[model samples]
Target chain A: MINRTRYLTQSVAKILIWIGALSTIAMMILILFQILREGLPVLHLGFFLDSPKNMGREGGIFTTIVGTVALTAVAIIVGAPLGVGTAIFLREYTRESKTSRVIRFGTDCLAGVPSIIFGLFGFVFFVIRLNMGWSILSGGLTLAAMILPTVISTAEESIKTIPSSYREVSYSLGGTRWQTITRVVLPSALPGIFTGILLSIGRSIGETAAIILTAGSSLVMPTSLFSPSRTMSVHFYILAREGISMKMAYGTGAALILLVLMVNIIAQWLINRYIRHRT
Target chain B: MAMKEKIIEKILLLTAFSSIFILGLITFFIFKEGLPLILKIGIKAFLLGEKWIPSKGLFGVFPMIVSSFWVTFGALLLGIPLGLACAIFLSELIPPSVGLLLRPAIQLLAAIPSVIYGFWGLIVLVPLIQNHFGGPGLSILAGSLVLGFMILPTIITISEDSLKALPPTYKAGALALGATHWQTIWRVLIPAARSGVVASVILGMGRAIGETMAMIMILGNAVKMPTSFLDSARTLTTNIGIEMGYASGDHRQALFATGVVLFFIIMALNTLAISLSRRRVH
Candidate 1:
């Protein structure tokens, strides 16, 4: 009788667990379905290429798309080198130093600070003090700061995972430390580095608060780095908050989700391919 | 040959060392921009002042601070148990194939952008609460619920890993002693994984406090202190995002002051989390 009871309980527990797991999947499908249901009718070629004007319902998100791409590009350009540099320092150069430990602590602290705080800092330091004045440059720099910790941590992990044998082989070939890092170690870890970059790009694309604060919501296509611009995420927020047509908001939202999803899929594929190739 | 190699090595070392300077620059910029505002506002007024009106130079961040803590605490209250239970089910009770499907689904939930969450909360959740509870569409309850779902993945993933890491012998020992599976989980697995569970909770709290877009959208952006769970409230993150756009003069500084306070709170939480995890590592 006890054995039967135990089996019954286990079966019940398994059912419960399955229910919990399925609920999450169901939620995601529901969200995607809702978004497509509301958003699909409005999606068009013009919607992707047109700029926002006349209360944003009639106009498309061309400028916002361009602005997002520009800001992300600039952020990657500015942040990637620094992040990779920091990672190299942590893993290869100062593996056990007090200064590196402090750097690691500070990086971790920076990572945990809220995105909104980064916005405030960006507003004061970049927009005002540096006189960038809520332009693309300010927004990009802010995003660079926001994503630095992510890049550093991911890069560091990737670097750490590179087998010591690769480094030893390079050294045996009489390669200098720099050569070993630049060639053997980094090549082995290239996929992880790319993964970090892709993750940062996804984060930058989805970011709303930091950009809204630092990047002024000018609906026009940015003329230059110093000019104000609106990103898709920011546009989505504005449309949602200002009581625009729900159809328009959903349309823009679907576009935003699609963009992120595409990037995520591509990045995951690239990382997987790289892993397979290396193996 | 020796000289050339030495020079190249020095250059590589210099490039590596520059990261230290970059980290320093980040901290310096944060404090440099934020400290003066704190000094001018006076720490007492900044912490305790009721009103946040910046026109007359009163920059009290107390209400925002209260709201931040309130939302975080509320989220923790809801998310921790559900997340832990989910983790327990995943780690202990579930079959391998089911665990695999569930794990990715949880990650996908985490990967969904906060803006989508805000939209979902606005359209679906806020109305549900308002219809039942009779308040404005935006309320602390809405914020907590949205944030609870947002941080659920964090807690679940961390707690699941911790539970998974427990020695199999521990479970067997309990089973041999005639403890039921549920009893062993409640009495043995949980206690043994206490530190990790604590870390997961802290991490969840950190995410909750830091979250901006969804909270801002759902919390009604009310600047006043919350009177009840149904009352609308603003958090430090939302306040910063809302005001940072047009703020100038003392108002801007006050925003930076808010950032400073947020920075310290997160810093403290992260330190605690790291130390706890390090202890477990040792």
Candidate 2:
């Protein structure tokens, strides 16, 4: 009887564990089904290619899509080099220095700050103080700051994972530290750096609050970096809040999700391909 | 050649070091804009005042603060157990092949933009809550549920990683002592990974509090104190999102102050999480 009871309890525990594993798939499917059910009917070619006109009565999301891509591209352009440079310093140049520790602490603090605070800071500093006046530049720069910590930390980790043997070999061959890092260490850590960049891209594309405050709600395609622009995330928020048009909002949302999903899929594919090649 | 190369390397290092200075400048800008508002409103009135009528020069954030905490607490209560269970399942029970397939799906959930969550919540979740709970189309319940789903991925991923990181010797020892797998997980593995699990939950809490788009979409945007989980509520992030458009004068400053409070809460939670994780490392 005791042996039978033990068997029963073990079986029950196994069942519970299986249930827990399946729950993740269940939740993902549920969310996908719900989004498609709500968003699919509104999807169309015009919705993708046209710009919202006269309070979003007509046209597609052309302007918003362009704005999102442009803003994200600008943010990447501004943030990536700074992030990569900082990582290089932390991992390669400043090894064991007090400045490196301080830099790491600062990056961690920056990462901890919430998105809304960044938004508030952008509103006051970028829009009011600098008189940038709610343009794509302001939005992109604020997002750059918001994502810098993530990029720096991830990049630093990737760099640190490189084996010191390669650097030592180069140094023994009379190579300077900079040459060793650029020629050997960086190549070894390239895949990880790519991963960091992909993650930051994912973050910047999905970010809404900082962009909303810094980039004014303008439906027009930004003619220049200094002009105001509306990202897909911000547009989705504005439409939903104002109860503008349910169909348009849902369509725009689907587009935003599709964009993010595509980026993630591409990143994963690249990482997988790189790993396979390396192995 | 050596000295010249050294100077170039030092210059590059200085440029890299300047990024930290840039981060400090950003933080200083936030404090400079927000501190004056906090000082003007005074801590007592800001913390204790019941009203949040910024239009009338009343900058009371008590309602928003309470509502933010209420919804975040509700979300935590709903999400933590489910996330932990999922983490345990993934780390201990599932076959390797199945775990591999499911891991990407969980990561994809994290990749979904918050706006889509907001849109879905506005169209579906809010209406469902209103029909069942007899409130307006927005409520703390709606916000919490959506926010709970939004942070679910973070909690599950982090906790599962931590659980996986635990040394296998503990589990082996437990099973060798005639303990069931579940008992081993609950008693030994979980206790060993407690700091990591706690960090995951705290991170989720921070995410929920800072989430703007989804909360604003589902929380009814009412600046009133939530009487129940089903009542319409406004979080600090949602408040800033909803009102930053046309707010001016003291009203805008009050929003800045609200942002300040939100910042500190997140900072505290994050500091605790970092220190706890660091302690676990040692």
**What TM-score, over all chains together, does every model reach?**
0.91, 0.94
Name model 1 segments beyond 4 Å from true. A1-17, A270-279, B1-34, B89-102, B164-184
Individual DockQ of the candidates? 0.45, 0.59
Shift in Å, residue B182, candidate 2: 1.1
Candidate 1 CAPRI assessment class: acceptable
**What is the C-alpha lDDT profile of model 1 across B46-148, one tens digit per residue?**
8888898888888888889999999888898878877887898889877886875566567666667898888888988899998999989698998998898
What is candidate 1's TM-score against the reference? 0.91
- Name the top lDDT candidate: 1
Regions more than 4 Å wrong, model 2: A1-10, A96-98, A274-279, B1-8, B11-19
Clashes of 2: 2
lDDT score for residue A265 of model 2 = 77
lDDT digits (tens) for residues B76-134 of candidate 2: 88788778878888898878878766776777888888877887788788888878878
Report the Cα lDDT for candidate 2.
0.81
lDDT per residue (tens digit) for residues A1-279 in model 1: 997787678667656656765565576788777887898888999998888877687779899999999899989998888788778877887667787767777776666767787777677678878999989999999898878887888888889878888899999999987888888878877888888898889889999888887888899778999988899988888888787767778989999888877776666667557656756
Model 1: fraction of the reference interface contacts it also forms: 0.41
